[model samples]
Target: MDSSIITIFLPIALAIVMAGLGLELTPNDFKRVSKHPKAVLLALFCQLVILTSIAFVICKVLTLPPLLAVGLMLLAASPGGPTANLFSYLYKGDIALNITLTAVNSIIAAFTLPLIVNFAIQHFMNDGQHVGLQFSKVIQVFLIIIIPVCLGMLVRYFRPELADKLNKPVRIFAVVFLIIIIIGAVAKERSNIMQYIGDVGAATVLFCICSLVIGYFVPRLFGISSTQARACAFEIGIHNSTLAMTIALTVMASTTIAMPAAVYSIFMYIFAAIFGTLLNRYAPSVQPSIEQAPN
Candidate 1:
C-alpha cells in the first residue's frame, strides 16, 4: 500500500520466495525436460499459448475493464507456483514432471511475461492511460524474477545443508508474504472490493476451470500418460498469483490491475483441490510407480 513497501519490501519478499523455489531446484531439473519431451512441450504450449489465448478471449467476451483485463493477462502469463507440485504429489500426478515444468516455466516467463504484459498494455490501455513495461521496468521484472532464483541455486550448490535449513522458513515466509500482498491489495481497494469481485469473479472462475480442463485434456488427447496429464493440469491451472499481484502493484503501480489476481488467489486453491479430487475419482486408474527424482 505504501510507496516504500511497493518500491522496496515487495520485491525483496518476492526475491526471497523465488530463492526458496531455487533451493529446491538444480541444473538437473531443467535437463529432465529431455526425458519427457512430449509432455513438457504440450504443457508449455498449454501454459504460454493456449491458456493466454483463452484469457484474452475471456477478457474480450466478458468485457472486463482495461486494467483488470491486463491483470488477467498477467496472471495467465505467470508460471505455476510450488503449490502445484504438492497437488501433483497428492493426486498421484508425476511430481518429477511438475518440478521440471516449474523450473523451466520460471525461466521462460522472464522473457514472455514482459512481451505479453507490454502487448496487453498497448492493446488495452489508450495513450494517456497506458502503463508500458519500458526497458527499466522490464529489467526490474527480470531481476525480481530471475536473479534471486539463480542466487538461491548458487546457495544450494555451495552450501546445500544451509539451503536445506532455510527451505521451510522461506516457504513459510512466502505464504505469509502472499497473504500480506493479497490483503494489502484488497484493502487498498476496499470500497470497490465488492464491485471488483462482482466484475471478475465469474471470469476468473471460468478461466480456472478452463485452465485445468485444457491443461489435462489437451495433453491426454496427445496420448500422454494420465499421471503426466494430471501434472499438466495443475501446472497450468495453479498460477503464481503472488508474482502477478506483485508486478501489478509494484511495477504497474495500479491496485486496480492487482484485483484480478488477488481475487483469483482466493478461489484458485479451492478450485484446484476440487478439480484434483474429481479427476482422481473419475479418471482411469494408473499403476502406482515409484516417484523418480528429476535427473
Candidate 2:
C-alpha cells in the first residue's frame, strides 16, 4: 500500500525469488527442450494461447470487475514455478520436461507478461482508473522479471557453491514473501475481501480446471506420452502466483488487481493434487524413465 513498499521492497523481494528460481536452473534445462519439441511446443501453445483465452472467456462470462479480470489475466500469463516440477515428480510425470518447460516458460514470460498485462490494463481498467504498462513501465517490468534471473544464472555459472547455499533460503523467503503479499493484499482490501473472493472464486477454479485439462489433453491428442502430458498439466496448471502478485501490486499498484492471484494460489495446489491423482488412477501406465530427481 505504501509507495516505498511498492516501488522498492516488492521488486527486491520478487528479484530474490526469481534469482532463487535461477539457482535451480542450468544450461542443460534449456537444452533439454530439443529432446521433446512437440511436447514443449504444445505446452507453450496451451500456456500462451489457450490458457489466456480461457481466462478471458471466464472473466467475460463471469462478468468480473475490471481490476479482478485483469488480475486473473495476469495470473494466466505467469510462468510455472519450481512447485510444478515437484508436483510432476510426486505424480510420476516427466520431471525433466517440467524443468525444461519451466525454464523456457520463464524466459517467454518476461516478454509476454508485459504485453498481456498491458493489454489487460487497457481493456479492463477504465480511463484514468489505473496506469497501464506503457513503454517505460514495460521496460521496468522486463527488468524486474528478467534481469535478476540472468544474474542468478550468472551466479550459478560462476559460484556454484554459493548458489547452492543460497538456494533453499531464497526459496523459503520466496514462499514467505508470497504469504505476506497475499495477506497484505487481503488486508489492504479487507472490507471487500469476501466480495472479491466471491467474485473470482468460481472463475479461478474453472480456469484452473480448464488449464489442467487443456495442458494434458491437447498434448495427448497430438500423440505426446502420458508422462509428458502430466508434466504439461502441472506446468500450465500451477502458475507462479508470486510473480503475478508482485507485478500486480508493485508494477500495477493495485491490490484489487492482486486478488485473483492470491485466491488462485489457495486453489492451485489442492486442485493440482486432485488432478494428478485422477490421472495416475485412470490413465494407462507408462513406466517412468529414470531421470535425475528434482532437487
Candidate 3:
C-alpha cells in the first residue's frame, strides 16, 4: 500500500468534497448553536465516551492486530460528514441541530481526530508495530481537511449565491466518489475479505450500535427534545470512514488496517436506517409549543 495514495489523493478528494460542504454552509448554521447548546454538548460527550469505551473493549477482548485495532478506533474518532444532515432530514430529525452539530464536529475533528488516532495507535500498537505519527503527516491532514474547509467558509462568506449553486454538484460527486471507493476497496481486498470479515464484523456491529444508542439518548437526558436527540445520535453515530481508510492505506500502509473502515462504510447506512425507523416508532412526537406553532 502506498502512503502517498492515502495521504495525498484521499485527502485531496475529501478536501474538495468538504469545500463543497463549506460553501453551502452559512453563518446561520453556526448561529444555530445557541438554540441547542445542551443537545450538542450531550451528543459530543456520548460520542467520545461510547466510541472510546467500545474501542478499548474490542481491543482487549478480540485481540485484534495492532493496525486493525487502531484503524477501528480511528474510524470511531472521526466525526460526521454532511451526509448526516441529509440523513437527519430523511429520518425526520431536527435538521437545524444536525447542521450545527456537523459544523462544530468538523471543526473539532481537525484537531481531536488526530489526537485520538495517535492515542489509539500508541495504545493498541504498543507491542512494536507502531508507525509513529510524523508531524509532516499531521500537516498533510490539516491541509487535506482543515485548510480547504476554512477556504470554503471564506467563499461562502464572500460569494453566497455561487456557494449555494455548487452544493448540488458537489453532493453528486460525493456520492459517486464514495461508491467508487467502497467498491474498489472491496474488489481490491476480495482475497482477504472472507478471512477478515468474520474477525471484524461483530466488533464493528457492536460499535455501531453503541454509537447510535449513546448519540440519541444522551441528548434527551440533557433536556434536548427527542428530535434534536435523534439528530445528534445519527450524526455522532456516523463516522467518516473515507478519512479513516485514507489514513490507514496512505499513512499507515496497512491494508489490514483499512479493512475495518471499508467494511463499515457499507454497513452503516443499513444499520442506521433500521435504527432510525425503530426510534421513530417508539419515540413520541415532539410537538412545537403553541406560540411557536406553524399556522
Number of clashes found in candidate 1: 0
Q: Is candidate 1 or candidate 3 better by TM-score?
A: 1
Write candidate 1's Cα lDDT for 181-279 as tens digits: 999989889999999999999889989999999999998899887888899999999999999999999899999999999999999999999999998
Better of 1 and 3 by lDDT: 1
Q: Write the per-residue lDDT of candidate 2 for residues 1-295, one digit (tens) a residue.
A: 6788888899999999998888877898888777557788999999999999889899899999999999999999999976898899898889878878888999999899988877887888888785678788788878887888888888998999999999889988988998998988888999999999999999999988898999999988987788888999999999999999988888778888899999999999999999999998999548453243211
Task: Tell me the lDDT of candidate 2.
Answer: 0.87
Model 1 C-alpha RMSD to native: 2.0
TM-score head-to-head 1 vs 2, winner: 1
Error of 1 at 58 (Å): 0.4
lDDT (C-alpha, whole model) for all candidates: 0.90, 0.87, 0.75
- The residue ranges of model 3 lying beyond 4 angstroms of the native Cα positions read 1-8, 287-295
lDDT of predicted model 3? 0.75
**How much is the lDDT of residue 233 in candidate 1?**
96
Best by TM-score: 1
Model 1 spans with C-alpha error above 4 angstroms: 284-295
TM-score each candidate: 0.96, 0.94, 0.90
Show the colliding residue pairs in model 1: none
Worst 10 residues of 1 by lDDT: 286-295
lDDT of 3 by residue, 57-171 (tens): 8877998777778878878877786777777877778877777777787777777777887888778776657575578877666666777778888889998888888888988
